[model samples]
Target: MNATNSQSPTIVLVHGALTDASVWHGVIRLTQAAGHHVVAPSLPLRGLASDAAYLESVPGPIVLVAHSYAGSVISHPATLDPKVKALVFIAAFQPDAGESSAELNERFPGSKLGPATTTVVPRPGGNDMYLKPEAFGEVYAGDVAPDVVSVMAAAQRPIDPAALGETLPARATWHDLPSWALVSTRDLSLPPQLLGFTARRAESHIVEVESSHAVPVSHPREVTEVVLEAVRCALS
Candidate 1:
């Protein structure tokens, strides 16, 4: 039932802040049903360098896909693995060399992920940030079912505040890799305008979907289609 050939790239799905790899559940199911091998890894969300290094360790010949803050993770120079053929960003950040996710998230005016919407918990190394359960649906997944949003909010993973401020390395993988982006028109966590700007700045092929920042969850079919497109282009 595998649709991919031996030469086809593996799909590596990276999740972002406030959520874990489970965010890609539907996308993984769809992608796998299409016969492609897929891996959605839980990022440490400690900082950009460490997170990128962890992602770099995944076996490759990969079509790397990232969501929200994970855009910064996959774009790190450390992830410039030769086997990584393409990058797919889903309502994600695509920070430049000196840019940080925090900076980019502020570039446009629409993000509702500020202090009032989130809670800060002091951890051993740094502050951990979480979206308040009440704010999760409106800010991160407005299009998703209330019941599903409830579980997502309860199971959400907190990310180190430091990770949002860490800048990318001097070089970025998008600088050399072919990339595609899916911009969520209804995203409130990362402004849709910010997403479009970053996507164009990377010269990435773009697709627009109507969903929340949790596009992978609310619109998995669209996300999977974009990933499959990247795979097709990479194989071509």
Candidate 2:
């Protein structure tokens, strides 16, 4: 990891399935206000390997922040990149080699997400899974305003079912790098227990918050604080 210098390291934010980069907007503003370089890229919800390959293209030596499924993406090339100094997971998954996210989601099985989603959309490569518009507020963003949830649901991106079932790469970056994880206590999409399990498995410095799966959106300040902690460690 690079020592603290005159310039802050770049911070790349990765969003998970059923959402786009816009989900990071709240956190982006907080990072920007703190004078850090931030980039929240949209991860195509095609599959894990492909998405990681795409994220690997970003110039790194960065503090990588990943939410939900994007957690799997950052665990590969981006996390392994010498340029990547720290990893921050926000109510995200941390699957190991040979482990599939679908299985992980069912590992504890307390999530309301399965029932909240619909798989009626047929895409080119595979079926697209989406959180039902009516269920979005209750399942994904319980703490968010109704109006905001409305907009989020309308703009929601459907994830390829294949992505959810994709096994992780042979290797993972979190195994080597220092990591921080934020667990949303109120999250129904990715249960807090599952998040805690993954975080502990990764040996991440963890903090729990009373928020939802959309913690980055509903509690940006807290999320930014954790990201900043990883940044501090990266530069130390």
Candidate 3:
């Protein structure tokens, strides 16, 4: 490969909370076939620092792509490398410096858009909650595949509610990297508008899909297109 093509950007898939990297299974093959390398890790579910550290172990100069709560996991500098060329968020939270996911839950009274699960757990490693599946499809990712959503609801690992309460000590590449975002119009959890707000911080190239929050599974073609674009950007 030529020198320019020699450094093709790799796509790092970061799945949201209560799920593992398997959540991205569908898109991986397509990405690799399209001529990009891909790496997605299972966040330790341990805590914020450990999870970020785990992700940092992946090869550098990555095009980090995150979905749902996984976006927060990628916000750390340890998980972030200098060669990381860009970021792509799929209905994911891309917070600016000194910002927390709490801002997403900073509800205006009567605002009906928040995680609807009755139980929220605080894992020792980070902030995440294992909400019920029915409650999940009803709230967080109603648009996801039924079977996968069922599995996610049933096997959801506990997340530390305190993960949100405590702040990380690093920067998200959104401030500097070339970024892109995929937003769903029918999302009930984070509301489409709220996603717009989170996306603004990214200064990203946005793709408004008419689907719901579980965008990767629901709209693989669209998600793949965005990933392709990010790879092209990074490799350029």
Q: Write down the RMSD of all candidates, one decimal each.
A: 1.0, 3.0, 3.5
lDDT of 1 by residue, 121-182 (tens): 99887888999999999999999999999999999889998899999868788989999999
Q: What does the lDDT come to for candidate 1?
A: 0.93
Task: List lDDT for all candidates, in order.
Answer: 0.93, 0.85, 0.71
Pairwise TM-score winner, candidates 1 and 3: 1
Could you tell which candidate, 2 or 3, scores higher by TM-score? 2
Q: What's the TM for model 3? A: 0.84
lDDT of 2 by residue, 1-236 (tens): 23324467789999998888999998888778777888887877887888887877777568889999988888764358788888999999988888877899898866887853654588666778888989889889999999999999999887887888888757678898999999999989888999999999999999999998999889999999999889888878
Q: Which one wins on TM-score?
A: 1
By lDDT, the better pick of 1 and 2 is 1
Worst lDDT 10-window in candidate 2: 1-10
